[model samples]
Target: MDARGWDERYGQTELVWSSGPNATVAEQVSGLKPGTALDLGAGEGRNALWLAEQGWTVTAVDFSRVAMEKALAAADRRGIALEAVVADVTTYEPDRSYDLVLLAYLQLTWDQLGPVLRTAAAAVAPGGTFLLVSHDLTNLAEGVGGPQDPAVLQTPEQVAGALGGLRVETAERISRPVEKDGETRHAIDTLVRAAAP
Candidate 1:
């Protein structure tokens, strides 16, 4: 969906996604020391806010104004500060390197995602981590709750292929359980964690 479409989806007053950080994000990032961080395609800034609460300086970038507004408002409510940037993540250029660069569930086709991932990887400082998580292409057949279109879905191979220089620490498909209609369903996700030299 385009930014306009996302704007409409986030126009409501209530939060659409969960207020807390994504489980995988908290799991992988909790071990690392807090530092300068950048969150690409940060919908509602959940992860960004969580990072700030952990003492990391965070910058949250997203194209949708409404989504960013909601995130900033939520930050205000929690007495946390974050750098909010409204811009297209696919082509955004960071002015400086970051200790941690994150891209969570920023679904896009290879034509769009390849460069975005490459650019984000390049923005990572030496010894820093670059973590990415997104709905896997196999989620449609073996999992639940993700984009039905395979064009936007990704795999570990696809993500690692885009990031050529970074040393990939972990690249695999991880399953997450979700509750729907009182039934537990699993969703598959591609997780890639790389380190910059």
Candidate 2:
């Protein structure tokens, strides 16, 4: 979906995603000390806000103005400060590097994702980390939630390969349990964490 489509969807609901940060993001970042961070495709700023609370100076970027507004409001309510910018990830060029560059559930086809991932990786400072989480390609067959379009889903290897010179720290497919109608099922996700040399 484009920014307008996302905006419409966000407008129809109070919150499109959970208020809390992604489990993978929280777990992976827990070991790292606070530093400057950049969150790409930051929808509602859940992860960005969480990072801010952890003492990281965060810049949240997203294409949807509506979503950014909601994120700003949420940040205000939490007494956390963050830089929120409305820009498409494909076209955005960071002015400076960050200690952490995060991309969560920013699903796109391999061809479309390559440039974005490279741009994100390029924004990472030396020894900094680039973390990404997205629906795995196998999610359509083995998962519960997330985009069903195969074109948008990617494998951990594909994500890792896009990071030109980053050292691969972790790249794997993981299953996450989701509850619906009192039943629990698993969703397949690709998690990739790389570091700049």
Candidate 3:
């Protein structure tokens, strides 16, 4: 989707996404002490705000103004400081690198995602980590709760393919289940954790 599309979605009353960090993100990184962190494509800044509460200096970037506003409000309510940026993640260029860079559930087609991942991975400080999660390509057939568009879902191999030069610590497909319309639906996700060389 383009910036205008995202802006429209976020303009609606309720947040499209939840107000908590992704389950996979919290499970994977909660043990680590917070530091400088960046949340790319941070719609509503849930993860970014959580990071700030954990003591990280957080930068949250998204294309939607309404989302940024809500994210700022959430941070204010929590008594945490969060820097919200109104910019497309596809083209955002950070002033400095971060200790942890998060790209959770950013469903983008290859044409849009390649350069962004490159820039995002490059924005990780040396010895720092770059973590990414997305709807698995197989999720179109096996998963739930994500865009049905096939072009946007990517596989672990695809993620590892684009994020070259980093040592991949973990890359795999994960299963998730959700109840929708009173029915249980299974979903798959691609998870990647890499360290900057």
CA-lDDT, candidates in order: 0.94, 0.93, 0.88
How much RMSD separates candidate 1 from the native structure?
Answer: 0.8
Lowest summed lDDT across 10 adjacent residues in model 3 is found at 6-15
Model 3 scores a TM of 0.95
Q: Which stretches of candidate 1 lie over 4 Å from their true place?
A: none
Where does candidate 3 stray beyond 4 Å?
none
lDDT of 2 by residue, 1-197 (tens): 89999999989999989999999899999999899999999989999999999999999999999999999999999999989999998889999999999999997777878999999999999989999988999999978889978999999888888899999999999998899779998999999999999
Where does the lowest 10-residue lDDT sum fall in candidate 1?
9-18
Task: Report the C-alpha lDDT of model 1 over 1-197, residue by residue, as the tens digit.
Answer: 89999999999657878899999999999999999999999989999999999999999999999999999999999999999999999889999999999999998898999999989999999999999999999999999998999999999998997887899999999999999889998999999999998
State the lDDT of candidate 3 residue by residue for 1-197, as single tens digits.
67777778887766787888888988877876688999999998878988898899999999888889989999999999999999988889999999899998887889989999998888988888899988998888767778899989888988887776888899999987788999987789999999888
What's the lDDT for residue 52 in model 2? 98
RMSD of 3: 1.3
Q: List the residue pairs that clash in candidate 1.
A: none
Off by over 4 Å in 2: none
